[model samples]
Target: MKTITSIQKHKGTTPLTVITAYDALFASLFDQKVDIILVGDSLNMSFNAKPDTLSASMDVMLYHTKAVCAGAKETFIVCDMPFGTYTDEKTAIYNASRVYAETDAHAVKIEGGIARAPIIKALTQNSIAVMGHIGLMPQFVRSEGGYKVRGRTEEDIVTLIEDARAVEKAGAFSVVIEGVVEEAAKRISEAISIPTIGIGAGKYTDGQVLVWSDMLGFFQAFQPKFVKRYLEGATLVQTALDAYIKEVQERSFPQTEYTYQK
Candidate 1:
């Protein structure tokens, strides 16, 4: 399990590995296998079939974080502060403190850059560990008209650097740079002292993260260009199910070895 100090020390030495898990089952599978496990709000889409992550409430996030903590006891866990829960400094502190008190999550992640720096600062000042998220934030999906990849131009890259700096200044142990241009992502990683975890932001970051369902090919609705399917999970599961159904129909499932003679 990597602590805040160890995770930050890994900035330029080695790349970190992060993956999202929504429950205890998968978290247990990934325990001690990855650098960090984030209980991301993206669960709303992949788990509940919601259109976006905005509807994920504090209760929902807390519930999932607790479950993940239970499964990944040896792994460092970060819980996401759901949208609208951290609108102000006071609110941010209250909600972030709840994460520390209510669960074993090591830190809390929040999306934003310079604009949200003060809130992040307040939380950190209160001894809360934070992980900053920049570039294309999913929380702003509807406000931005849709998910947009940032850092196309030189100006955008400069702004990204500023954002990274602000997050570091706000005392975040790390930051997630998502959905950005590759070159820009590299620049941002170089500009920050903390580790930069990339998701769809390319290989130049200090680390990479992916939703478990996306990488495992479980979510069949839509595939993002960044997600590399490691396994045909859905197909494999369906094929196994079909075999089980056939066995049951043919009265071949319950063999002598599987039953008690007495």
Candidate 2:
């Protein structure tokens, strides 16, 4: 029953586990295993077949957040503030407040760093918990010229550290460090009192997160190098579909075994 703030306070001493869930089943499945469940806007790419997170909206996020929160009875749910929902302090607070009121999420995550500090502060001050996201934010995919690693140079590292500090100062309970150098993530984790949840950042992070679809091999087109497939669901689902088709063609389905006896 520990709050996200309590978890952040004891981060390094106790590693946190996080994962993205777009619906009820996955959220229920991962609830026990993960310390946090993010109703991520990555659903646009993972579910709706969009190229990236850009097409996701507040309504889409709210729909999924509600589903995930319904299933995640015990886990702390963090809803993603989708693209274009929070461009400034006033808008950020308004949208974030709506999300808090509508979803069962314990917090809201916004991508950016120093530039978003005011918005973050405003949300936190109004009693909505905030989780900061930095490094390879998907909402910035078009601006960043596609997905890429960050903090390769000294200046970039410095900027990342500053970003982390700013997020902490803005009163975020934790921050996600995505696709950044391991050393940089580690340094940031150490520097901030708030926890650092990493995705493709490395093992030294306070916690790690991955898209549930990617981890379960539901997406067959491509997989990130950092994602490890725990289940080959894509191939399995295809095989099942093929079997059903063959059964129907041969009239093998709706057999006595599957039919209800009078």
Candidate 3:
């Protein structure tokens, strides 16, 4: 089982692989293959049919985390603290405690940096492991005015590196650099002591993560430029369903061999 310490150890030695899993079924598939199974709030769009992650509530995240933890007993699980839950240290610790206590997750990932450094420190000081998130924060997308690549400008790149340093200083076991320019993400990865996990942030980071649906082609929604579809899962499921429907309509589904013997 990969713990926070193990993930930290892999920083310069090897690149880690992380993927999102919203339920036990998917968790079971990649539990042993991947280094970490994250109960990401992207499930707002991936599962709840929401336009963004802001709609994901604590209850919804917990429901999925519980399911993931149940199945990935030997794998390290990280739960996302959904929007409106990590407002302050007290609140962050309160919510993080429940996540660790109830779901059996190994750690909690909180978005933001510098500004949230104190909150991260509080959680870590209280014995809760934390993973930091920077760059294109989905929770702030509405205010950030939409999803856009970060670290395109000098000021933005500097801020990103500063954010990485701040999170590292705040005691995060690892930090996720998302949707940034490849160069900037690479620089940040070098600047931080903890492992840097990238999501569309390029190949230079210590680890990589992707929404499982994006890589699997499980949904027909917008595809991001960074995602490489490895399998047409949606099409395969659709074809199977179509065949099932036809066989049922043609009254061929209940063959004699499929029935119970008298």
Who wins the lDDT comparison?
Answer: 1
Look at candidate 3 and tell me the lDDT of residue 98: 91
The 0-to-1 C-alpha lDDT of every candidate, in the order given, reads 0.95, 0.89, 0.93
Kindly report which residue stretches of model 3 are placed more than 4 angstroms away from their true locations once superposed: none
lDDT of 3 at 105: 94
Pick out the ten consecutive residues of candidate 2 with the lowest summed lDDT. Answer: 1-10
State residue 180's C-alpha deviation in candidate 3, in Å: 0.3
Tens digits of per-residue lDDT, candidate 3, 1-262, equal: 9978789999887999999999898899998899999999999998788899998889889999999988888899999999989999999999999998788899999999899999999999999999999999999999889998999998999999999999989999999999999999988998889999999999999999999998999977889999999999999999999999999999999889999988
lDDT of 3: 0.93
lDDT per residue for candidate 2 within 1-262, as digits (tens), equals 4487577766787778888998898788887778889888888888898888888889889999999988889998899999998898888888988888888789999999999998899998899999999988898989878898998988998999999999999999999999998988888888888889989999888888988889989987788888999999999999999999999999999899899999
lDDT for each residue of candidate 1 in 1-262, tens digit (9 for 90 to 100): 8999899888877889999999999999999999999999999999899998999999899999999999998999999999999999999998999999999999999999999999899999999999999999999999999999999999999999999999999999999999999999999999988999999998888889999999999999999989999999999999999999999999998888998997
Question: For candidate 3, what is the total of clashing residue pairs?
Answer: 0
TM for candidate 3 is 0.98
